[model samples]
Target: MLRTLTRQSPLFTSSVRGFKTSAAAFVKAGDSVPSLTLHENSPGNTVDLAEETKTGKYVIIGVPGAYSPACSASHVPGYISRGGELAAKGVDGVFVVAVNDSFVTKAWGAELTQGKDSKVPVRFIADHAGDFATKWDVLFDASKFFGNKRSKRYAAVVENGKVQNAWIEPDSTGLDVSTAEKVVGQL
Candidate 1:
């Protein structure tokens, strides 16, 4: 029974079967962000990226998963700590996106925002189905560790729905290029 259920799971099925695409198709500077609805705490409470970025500058941080070591310890913290600095640079909001369920993402947000009076307005977004990551062409097979597809670590500065700058980590899981300090400096 367990074997049957495991085989039927989407992650198992997709990873086992496989999909292919051109690596050159990833989002880049000058490209308009794809329209998608990401969930914050629940699917009912959705954030529409197209509408959100229609007016001001937004920094989108894409991570492989929520609560991962690098993501929890450094990536998200850097952005949270530098939220004021980023805001001063004309950023309207910093969105941390991860390929996890809304519940997990929300819990992670709470963990990061704990004890903060006026918490850094960073939004934690859940790309549960990987639709947003797929559209951005940042979705990569992470089945070995995560059992499903995950986003390549990256950061993008969007102005009025179009990308003004993009920094994708050379090694999808590295913390070099997509760090908050590096991305904010590019902004």
Candidate 2:
């Protein structure tokens, strides 16, 4: 009888696994942000994410790496190309966040924006030490990926510091749910 009950309880068995094995990612709509104090690439300014989102609406776009194919070719460009439209649609701030250091983010920004003064008008920031990624629970082991930890592809739209929408990828590096088009639709 005891063995049958134990085998029957899938929910109970899963509850014990906790954060490590769960495919279901955390951040959900209406959840308050965890922290601020992130590093931006340009001029090396340290930004407080919470403070920046206070204006109106903010979009946090996370990618596996700064210069990865999907990220550079599509993920970022999708946002960069539409930055004006998004802003015109009434978004206050749009940020691209990656797990790499600030320098890489800056360079990636330049490349994506075509070396203009500010091609996208979006801030390209780095989450050094994986602080932001960890807080958001989107950080993943990427030892084989460019020799470092990396952020899983995801996007969040925040309003007044609360998440209005969260689209986390099922596969750590997949871009299905977190694409710019999806985020824009949410906005």
Candidate 3:
């Protein structure tokens, strides 16, 4: 069969016209962390990740939700349990960030830290509006599993407000990469 020319043909496409389509760049090594105001414990308490990372080495962990199964079971707990080792390796703090409200984050943080002898400070921060996740390029649509947008599971090693290294979950919310053991050992 012979094909006829059509307006929808690939040859008659925007790409062939040389129009460029661009997507926002994801946060990676050498990228400067943005200065987005976040909250810890309460709205009154503000956490500035950029400023916190400026003085020393820090790990910023992004999660999909505050009390989800994976996040509650292993992800955040790994970082909390290994906080001492992280501190010994010169890590100043571990910030657990989620796109939940301050109340949820505060309660989760307290529960996770209860009776744990973590040496480094592990602070659970609320990215209530997902602005931080968007800036980091890790925000995703999780309306199917979650109610709204959620952050991809990720870990970024920041030094002096610049990313030294980073790991983003290939599946958006997978458990393979960005584990505390994997990231901390490298640091």
Candidate 4:
């Protein structure tokens, strides 16, 4: 007879099952994106993914935090600093996404683009409670971050509503795998 497993072991079977369930909805390369409308911070105008990706190359960048050390110093700034170069290579639009509110996203976008004079302006978009993150499979339980959730550091290059490339960090939070330089290189 097979012995029934209990929660006595160091590892919980339920935890493993939950992990598998959570990992199943992730978006991957060659997968078409779902239709969603995201707004630009200032204008508050809804941008439809179906429409945006139909005409040009758009890059969706996900950040764990807006002003964190790695993100502020390198991840976002790296893209803002080199927006032109990326644009020149046929990138039509660049968007930064986070699990913050619309207001915070607006402020961060303005701050990031200040004094850059970049032709390819980066739009900081609020995922608003990780709805977008959940859809993209990038949401993390970052209670330490802000007593709530946050997005993973990853980048997806979309063309015509289809993912041309997806660079996701294995560790959930880090600058090692995902960066503008690396993502742009894929384009």
TM-score of each: 0.85, 0.80, 0.87, 0.82
Q: Is candidate 2 or candidate 4 better by TM-score?
A: 4
Q: In order, what lDDT does every prediction score?
A: 0.87, 0.80, 0.90, 0.77
1-187: candidate 3 lDDT, tens digit per residue: 1255556577655655577878857789999888989998899998888887888899999999989998999999999989888988999989999999999999999998899988998989999999999998899999999999999999999998999999999898888789999998899
Candidate 1 ranges beyond 4 A from true positions: 1-23, 117-120
Task: Name the best candidate (by lDDT).
Answer: 3
Can you write out model 4's per-residue Cα lDDT over 90-156, one digit (the tens) per residue? 8887888887777778888787778886568578887776777888888888898668888888888
- Give the poorly placed runs of model 2, Cα more than 4 Å off: 1-25, 42-44, 115-120
lDDT assessment of candidate 2: 0.80
lDDT per residue for candidate 2 within 1-187, as digits (tens), equals: 8888888988547655455555655678987776667888743688878777766778888888988999988887888777776776677767898887888888888778774332236888888778888888888889886688888898888888889888888888887888888777767
Ranking by lDDT: 3, 1, 2, 4
Error of 2 at 62 (Å): 0.6
Candidate 3 weakest lDDT stretch, 10 residues: 1-10
Q: Mark the 10 consecutive residues where model 4 has the least summed lDDT.
A: 15-24
Overall local distance difference test of candidate 1: 0.87
Which candidate has the highest TM-score of all?
3
